[model samples]
Target: EAATATATAAAGDDGGGAWRVVGGDASADGGESPTRGDASRLSRAVDVWSLGCVLYGVLDADEHPYGSWFEREVNVINGKRNLDRIKHLPEAHALITALIEEAPTARPSAVEALEHPFFWPDARRLQFIQEVSDRLDKITVDNPMLDSLEGRSSAVFGHRGWQVVLKPSLLEDAGKHRYYRPHSVRDLLRLIRNKRHHYRELAKPLQLELGDNAGAFYRYFAHPSRFPGLLMAVYAFATEYLAHEPLFAGYLGPETARRYAADAKERCASAGASEEDMLAAEEAARAAALLSGDTLQETRREWFPREDAWGDAARFSVSSAAAAREAAGALGSAAGLPPVGGPAGAAAA
Candidate 1:
């Protein structure tokens, strides 16, 4: 056990305090695994607690609020933590409380933490999206009170009173990265899916009532490919937010930011983006990064594969073993492969 140790030197003490990194007399198992109260074992809950502690340090100027290593042991034994000390982020206080909650079952998962409102204003943004999306069907009005300037009519999405849907449905506030970024993809996707089916069936007939904006939304998202504009908007929002987030902000100096920006532009171009769109996104990201503090320093990173490669940004459900086996079996039959238990198929070979 690399981090296991016992405090046998102290009377009434058992296997704990791994920072000591040495087991003591009359101690076994050390503290290599985690324990809470009477229960002791390896667990993701234990890791979540550790993550909370590490985050507590990162957000608090690398200072451990638990005093010393020995002090933390005392706190754990008493089932208490100093989570309230992270006052700089009032929006995150509830999150910090939840992370260090004494009950193991009460703790939230990593994905939950990433999706939490503490990181971004998810509810507000979603509400804003819904409000504007609903208004798209109101039929772009020309303010009948005003004088007619020319033969042109004001239905935005289409040419006539029946058509409000624009050709390239231009969003009103797309450039405002601060207001539009989505902290939670799950939340955004949920809102989009929830609205898609109802609006799809009602789009044409309802465009008579709702107008062209609703028609535009329905037409764009009704397909199997889903709405690329909304998807790209969410992706762009994340990129902009991450670039300017307090933890990562200003960590990339201009030169390094430029290099990263160029790398991103190249990647975007490879992903079938026009050179112009690529440059636009790159510039936006770079500008966002520069808006924060200076003095470049490395930002924190998660361990393992995420450390070596890009973090798994796209969430997906896990595949089951049975599903894998069934698929493989079907593929083998199509390929005319030997069946299982065929004695290595010597004659066929």
Candidate 2:
């Protein structure tokens, strides 16, 4: 019976009893996990691929490892994967790449996969990220309030062509006419750091008379070690952090830091600030926009996905990945995934 099953598993019809993953876009989907490989088939390679998908989910934070189910299938059919997203973690990229090789014969068996070196923790890798984070933390700039950073315009950016709006959840009826990619921990850390720079304009008012150590918390944003109490504030009250940046952009801090802080508070109050961050501090508020120079956090490119201006109804469907793949090879390629055959030493590939 075992021998019979083993021989039959390899050449099953194109999708005969083959498991199919089912789900929606996960970047902004907030609910139960939106993707899973159905176990309708008994192929060992299928099991291995499923394992790889699950692992991808685990590591990529809230992101669907290969995006939606249809996206994963198209990649599988073409011997490709969104491995570039995982490339940051070399071990994960290698293991998943191997496990999902298009050829069943090329994939590792369950026993073989469990023992792969990628599973082992690499202290060197940890240290390297630490080094990167540390180096990035030391970076400094002048007058973030005066800077003109270009980013995916927020909801506050005035619902123009494809703005990147951050909302809490994705209800089925909600108009999700947008493309999204989940942010990484490093990205969050970078945001924290940027907030310290740009959002600190709000905090500028009270820095002086507050105390000698008033602005001491300025630079300690997201260092791997010695993370400050302010981090918890950012984490716990993140909604405020999200709201402040967009609203502050509307204000021009032309007067004293105190005056600017006061003016900013009234303006931001209309923009929905929680009044927890810079607006709450007198000195920080006063300094919010004293700069006649470049305003904070300006950039040339938008980092996150913007709203799809067309807002085509088809773009938001669960079946859309396959449809898009079949149409213009759009979804996965548009996803910016790395090409296949990354890393080395799989159970087979």
Could you tell me the lDDT of residue 246 within candidate 2? 37
Compute each candidate's TM-score over C-alphas: 0.27, 0.25
State, as a TM-score between 0 and 1, how close model 2 is to the true structure: 0.25
Candidate 1, run of 10 with poorest lDDT: 1-10
The superposed Cα distance between candidate 2 and the true structure at residue 139, in angstroms, equals 43
- In candidate 2 the C-alpha lDDT for residue 20 amounts to 24
In candidate 1, position 141 carries an lDDT of 22
For residues 96-200, write the lDDT of model 1, one tens digit per residue. 666655655566666656644456443343433443233221211231111111111221111332112222222122222222213322323333434443444
lDDT of 2 by residue, 62-131 (tens): 5554455445434444444566677545446667777766565566677556544354233322322233
How big is the positional error of residue 61 in model 2, measured in Å on the Cα after superposition? Answer: 4.2
